[model samples]
Target: MANALSFTFIHVLCLLLHCSASSAQNVVFQPSFLTIHGPSMTALLYGFSSKITLNLQAIPSSNVTGSFVPPSCVPGVTQWILTSELIAKTAVQVKLRLNRSLRLCGNNETDTDCCVKPLCVLETLQLTACEGNTSQASLIIQVKIYALLGSGNMVFDNSTIIQNQVYRPLGDCPCDLTFNTCDLWCCCDKDCSTADFKLFRYRCLTGPFGGQFPDPEYQCSVQSTQNSPDWFPFLCVTSPPENNPYLGLFYQGNTMAPKPGISFGGSVSLAPALSNAYTEGSPILTIKDQYFTIPQTLNGHCVTNAPVAFLKNLDVRCVTSVQACPTEFPLQTIPEDLRAVVKNGIAVFVGNVVVDVTDQLATELNEFVTSSDIFGSSGLVCENVTLALDYNFHWKENGITGITLTRTVGSVTLKGNVSLTTRYSAMFLSGDIMSEPNSGNPGYQVGRPVIGGILNTSIGNDTVLIARSPMHLWKPVNSGICSSADVRPLLFGENSTSGCLIPVSRQNLTECSLLRNSVHSLQGALIEATLVARNGHPDALTLADWLNITYVTLNSSGVEDSNSSCADIPSHLHIYLWTLVSGFVDGIPQKDIKAVQISYSLSSWRLKCGGGDSAVCMDPAETQLLPITSSVTFIDIPLNTGPPKTRYQINFTEYDCNRNDVCWPELAFPITRFYTGESYSQALAKGLILVFFFIVASVLGNPWRQIRQIWNTI
Candidate 1:
């Protein structure tokens, strides 16, 4: 019976051991207040036989409270002691504050003044009874801390087992097991373990999450970075390809040929209304039995072998008559050398004269003569006749040499020392003899009709010489007297003051004055001469109705003893003379002819004038020879007394003489009158000096004033 009791005891012991092992293998504890930031509390109860002893202890919680309580037992101990039996009888509570507040021990001990909160230590409870008989009890607690309540889950195991008087544990109660959900710590290298529970392993939704899955049709687009490798993948999946339409079927890489359509008729017939009758709707003629025809003629016209007559075999009316043939009319014959002829209804030179007989006939006689032979007894009579001679000649060949007679006249002659040199001298004569009367006009005294001539005579060395003057002998009276009065007789030597003569005693007079009145006939004459006389002699005169001199030289140095003589004639008149000169020959050498001068003597009514460097002079006393009138007047001088072929001219209108007005001075003055007061050189020098000072003052004065102003301001 004892042997049987031992076996049963052994089997009972084995059964108890098996039950203890199974119970201790894993322990579970539930947590209270599983918040993300606070500590979690898990309560564990040891499940074993009531005979076993357990030690009740407190483990420092991760988030410890300032006041902590150990695990309670059915049989409470006065002091904090842990035993195996107490553990099995009562549940052990471990209040773990994940982020615990700890008190810092220092000189300041009040809870409010504590520097730091006390840290809880991770611990395990031990129960020992006679060391040999030992068993371990473990509890597993799972705590889920979330960013918010019911957000996420976190599990920790706090299980342990005692084997051979030592505890074998899977892990500590996951001390400092933290979770974070804050985005601040969720980056690649950040510590997310301290972040809020919701931040741990958190992923962001593409759009707002309202507890519903994203729509499948509405794709969740991912924004790709510029550097992303898979950037083109999205484009390939979203877009598709399109097809082209302009392709044709191919055979062996070549285009296929299209099938042909049906053709119904060989030729179509059009109605007669749309066709030409001549063409027979064919537009051609056919010779063969073929489907086509060749065009015989274009434009639907018929081809013919013979010419066609448009109008044929019509009876035409006719009138019979006879027309006369034109007869040749008799023409008037012209006789040559008859001086006048008529041909073709035109009366040409009918006689010796080839008369130009138009409505108004103009005859030009290049060579003209006036004599009884050509003019006959009646003389050449006309209403008005103009005879123009470019140059005249009639002179005694022995006296005047190199003289030209340039006048329009009926006759010419030469007397005195006049001589002819040119072979073609017109109307030349010798000696100073007079001609006798001829037939016709028996009572007319025609001793030698005063002839026109030009004489070039030099004043000989003999103090007394005499010549008949042509100008004083027969002055040109009006044309009304040409018929009644005979021309004055040509004379030589000192005859009478009334006749044409030059006294030998008056040879001291300048030759210019002698020929001055020759041109007064107003019948065209151009005379050029050189005259020499004493300076300021008043006899030196360049006289003409109009005179133009190119140059004049004065030799006043020949005068005795005076430093300077009046080498220039002071008075001059210019009718239409254009005079250019080198310089004025003045008594004062310094007086340059740069300006015009005018001097007048009111007592004598005399005026003296000078031009700037001209070689002409006038006599102020000659004003008496001009006609006096109240009206402005012009003197018409015939440049040539001839037909329209000659050029004629007139002078400018001169105002009438006014003795009462000082402003109307005489139009004559000395040559030095233009420069009477001011020298040209002195005026020019003064002007330049004034200009120089003006420029200098303008340049220096302005800046100096500015400098003074600036100095005053400073």
Candidate 2:
């Protein structure tokens, strides 16, 4: 059994020895490529067309086999010469000549030719592969290129700090070469304070040449006593891996903290809206896709400047004193009958050009815009813009009152927060290393980039240097401008100025300045009011409004006994009846309305199922209703939030309101006392006479009368 085990072990050892010998022989055949294959083949792009060049480099290979052949020998299977050349458009090729050939290893320490001999020439580059096969070109490398305009490419940083200005050898310099390569140790005297000692310093006296060196080590117990105190200079050298002389000193790892999420840079510019004088067409700015929530001026509550971006092609409006045009009206100050116009106007900062948009364009430009698609690789973040609007105004109901700038725009801090767009294109470095977003300065980048939460056109005026950060992921977002929770009535008198519902002895109808002069018409005080319905639930069927009398709880006895003819009912109930009946003809004989039926809700907008770009539209059913109450202090049917709160329209029309109401009572049918179709009155007298004759005949024994009475009865 022992002999058998020994035989197996001997065979296994022989096999292992054979495998090792074969592996050693594979080295000479497997040559070090020293070629560009994957990552080295980088491309570059420029925003605008410009001339550019790349520095080409080469030196004799430092392989073991390279030294076996003589330097004078041409490159065959052994000796190789690193020759540089430029291929322009593949046809106009040119060779770069060196002043002197560099030595693979120089003999003297101060020999410059051995280190600085490099051939250099600038030439136009083609976006294609090179075709070269010269006698000395033994180590030809392959490179991939894609020079497109604004393509967002990348270039790696490979130049070493130590050799930035200094010349370099063919490869890594050996320790036996020169004092520059060997004297990398650090040492300092013990007298030097630890804080005062520098890790690296540049001095010409102590060092061999005029250059920098690592910190001196104090532990070396030796002294130089010429004039200064005896001091020892010990040694401290860096450990392996980290001690690499080429790149170990100045390398910053690619790492960056995640951003504070995508944010909107605040910017606003009002469109130029000076109008009301000239009767000819002019220039206006065209607005593309962008969301705008425009507020019209009522009393003084809405639509002003928010922080935003610059407008295009705007001509400043002429001053009233300068041009003598229709005086422009400022916002909040409504004229009596509210009538005005805008003439020629000019505004600077928006490129001083005349824009020819419509009157609606200037006033409603905010509402006229929405969001759009992002372009590629250039973080062209969209900014918010608000414009100051100024136009003319005049108002008249029966009398006349006026104020300019009825609905105007001015500078204002925007309300609420803005959000990021939903889609992101291939614009800007994703900052991911070894992945989709590689960290590095983009080669020849352009367009606005979102940095520190703002869109910047350039880094700085003089120093436009750009850098990228290491990638970290918090989350990806694609958001849009959200809707605000605001609704307004926009009804005429019911707006910011005045309305019905003053519980005082004087009716609200007589309160309007336009009507304050005359309280009564020939018949009575014409119930002066502009009835309004909630923008939502205009359907009319049933609603408990801050004004509309729907579902309500009345206080102070739910009834009013002003008229003895009708029964006492809920106070709001009676008002609801009156508020509604005012729109109807004088004597329609309407039934008593006590309460309104509550139906659909209005918390959010109703998205259209079949609509395309119009997916989001206003749906009257989705309303935010006011709670029903009956405090009954002469509740004004017109609740005015003022100016931008709502859009105004004519008072309620009977047909529309009645149609929207689902609970309106049916009319009664008339009843007649007599049946005209049957001639009963005509037959009544004949029947009476016949009855009398029959009675007489019965009394006087007349058979004829008795017969006639019988015939009549028949």
Task: Supply every candidate's count of residue pairs whose N, Cα or C atoms clash at under 3 angstroms.
Answer: 66, 81
What local distance difference test score does each model get?
0.25, 0.24
Candidate 2: regions farther than 4 A off: 1-368, 374-399, 406-594, 597-714
The lDDT of model 1 is: 0.25
TM-score for candidate 1, please give it: 0.11
lDDT of residue 593 for candidate 1: 13
Q: Model 1 off-target regions past 4 Å?
A: 1-40, 57-107, 110-133, 139-714
TM-scores for candidates 1 onward, in order: 0.11, 0.15
Which one wins on TM-score?
2
Candidate 2 per-residue C-alpha lDDT over 229-277 given as tens digits, one digit per residue, 9 for 90 to 100: 2221112233443223344222243333432211111221222232222
Query: lDDT score of model 2?
Result: 0.24
